[model samples]
Target chain A: LAKTTQPISMDSYEGQEVNITCSHNNIATNDYITWYQQFPSQGPRFIIQGYKTKVTNEVASLFIPADRKSSTLSLPRVSLSDTAVYYCLVQGSARQLTFGSGTQLTVLP
Target chain B: EPEVTQTPSHQVTQMGQEVILRCVPISNHLYFYWYRQILGQKVEFLVSFYNNEISEKSEIFDDQFSVERPDGSNFTLKIRSTKLEDSAMYFCASSERADTDTQYFGPGTRLTVL
Candidate 1:
């Protein structure tokens, strides 16, 4: 398991793009970067995952640099409902996934 | 989307009492996991099950904790003795595979141990 560091909190307004970056300096070769979003009183939900380069889905985009030491989760045109805690996890096979304190994203109206 | 479902949205129990939390994972998923979040804390992994056996478990999963897949559709977690520290939101999740598949999580069972 690779330890991850992200901001403690972020503030965004409606219709603006929000990008949250995670730093995993000790990332291993087999580790993959995965992002999850959790609202209060709910389970975490998978947002995006990537091994390298960039991957995009209906909800968000993940950008992994060439070094793979860090990754960014980008959410476009955010809304108030997007307010949640975002977690960045790095792990390989046969390892228990760990979640850090995560970045608390507050989407203001 | 097929999602995991957990029973007893909220459970209140006394100290030293045994409690069982049940979950119904996605129909096609093969890997199951249990995680808990102490209020205002990070989510912690408890255990992962695959092929009718435990693949991984955290230190938090002590002797008091056990997991079982009684039948094809249901997965369960048992706490032999509850403590006040056991109060937290227990989440059940499942993935199609363990390597890179995305895990879908249930709403969670909020256990309050007094």
Candidate 2:
């Protein structure tokens, strides 16, 4: 399993963009980087995923460099409700998942 | 969109008692997994089930833990004896295939050990 490290918390003002980065120095060849967002008292929901380069979706953007040692999750135009714990997962199959403490992104109003 | 479903949103059990957690994964998904998150801690993988057997298990999933697909629709995690340390939010996840990066999660079951 690929171990991941991320910030404990981040603050973002409403309408501002937020970026959370994760480091996975031992990422394996078959591993893929994925992010999930979790609000208090709720299960995590998938945000975005990428193997390399960059991938964007309606919710967030994933940027994985060629080295695959680190990845960033970008949230655009943050809102008050976007305050949640953001997890970065490095996985090959679903079985090999390793979710870190994640970045607690607090969107301020 | 279709979603994975877990039964008994919350459960409280005494220490040393057996508890069974049930889940219904998405219809087309081929891989199913169980994860648990202690309050204020990171989510930890427990085990993965595929082809009617376990593909991998974590050290956290010790001898007291077992998983079964009792029926076509229901997947279950059975903990033979609960401990206070076992209290956590257990989540069920499913992926369409082994290589698929997307793993849909079901609302977790909150297990309280006392």
Candidate 3:
């Protein structure tokens, strides 16, 4: 399994864009990057996933450069409801998954 | 919008007692996993079961912990001897496959050991 690093917390205001980046220096070729969001007391919800390049969905966008060492999760025009802990993970074929501390986004109004 | 379901949203048990946490995964999912999170901590993986056997597990899952798929519809985690440190929210998750598939989580069972 590949290890991942992310910031402990981030602060953003409503209507502003927020970007949280995760580093996985030992990422393997078969690893796929996936992002999940968790609100207080709720299960982590799937946000977006990407192998490389840029992938955009109705909720958020994931950007991975050619190196794939790191990836960025972009949330445009964030709202108060977007305040939550975002987890970046490398889903591997074997082993139980691992989750990091995650970047807690505080979207202050 | 099918989701994983777990029983006893919250459980309170005395130390050294036996406790069972149950889960019913999505109907189509082939892989099942158990994870736990202490309040204000990162989620930790415990075990993963597929095809009626454990495909993978973490160090956290010791002899004290066991998993079973008693019947076709239910999966369960059994703790033979609960310790004070076992107080944490246990989450049940399932994926369509054991490899390269996203796992969906349940609301979690908050276990409080005294």
Candidate 4:
């Protein structure tokens, strides 16, 4: 498993774009980067995942540079409901998954 | 979409007592995992089960903790002797595959030890 570091918190306004970056300098070739969004009192939901380059989904987009040392999660046209803690996880074949403290995104009204 | 479901949304128990947390994962999922989030803390993995046995477990899972899929439709985590620090939100998650598959999580069971 590779360790990841991300911002503790971020502030964004409604209708603005938000990008949360995660750094995993020791990421391995077989490891994949995955992002999950968690609301208060609920379980975390899968947002997007990428191994290399860019992967876009209906909810968000994940961009991974060639170096794979870091990845970014981009959310377009955010709303107040988009406020939640986002987790960046780097996992390999083994099942010993670890989650960081996560970045809490507060969307201002 | 089918989702994982857990029993007794909230449980309150006394210290030194035994408690069981039950969960029903997504029907077709193959791998099952148990995680806990202490108040104001990050979610930590406890154990992962596959093929009727534990595939991996974290250091937090010691002799006091145990997981069992008693039957086809139920997965349970039991703590033989609950302590004050055992109080936390327990989440059950399952995935269709072991690698790179999205693990669906269930609404957690909030356990409060008095």
| Per-candidate local distance difference test | 0.94, 0.90, 0.93, 0.94
Give candidate 1 misplaced runs (Cα > 4 Å): none
The pairs that clash in candidate 2 are none
Docking quality of model 2: it rates as medium
lDDT of 4 by residue, B1-114 (tens): 999998889999999999999999999998999999998999999999999999999999999999999999899999999999999999999998997788888999999999
Deviation in Å, model 1, residue A53 alpha carbon? 1.0
RMSD of 1: 0.9
Off by over 4 Å in 3: none
Task: Please provide, for model 2 over A2-87, each residue's C-alpha lDDT reduced to its tens digit, 9 standing for 90 to 100.
Answer: 78899999998999989899999998888888899999877889998889999999988999989999999999999999999999
Query: Which pairs of residues have clashing backbones in candidate 3?
Result: none
TM-score of each prediction: 0.98, 0.94, 0.96, 0.98
Chain A vs. true chain A, TM-score per candidate?
0.97, 0.95, 0.97, 0.98
Question: What is the iRMSD in Å for candidate 1?
Answer: 1.4
User: lDDT: which is higher, 1 or 2?
Assistant: 1
Residue A75 deviation, candidate 4, in Å? 0.5
| TM-score of predicted structure 3, chain A | 0.97
Candidate 2 or 3, higher TM-score?
Answer: 3
Number of clashes in model 1?
0
lDDT of 1 by residue, A40-69 (tens): 999999998999999999999999999999
Question: Mind giving the per-residue lDDT tens digits that candidate 3 earns over A44-98?
Answer: 8889889999999999999999999999999999999999999999987775778
Candidate order by decreasing DockQ: 3, 4, 1, 2
lDDT of 1 by residue, B1-114 (tens): 788999989999999999999999999999999999999998999999999999999999999999999999999999999999999999999998886678889999999998
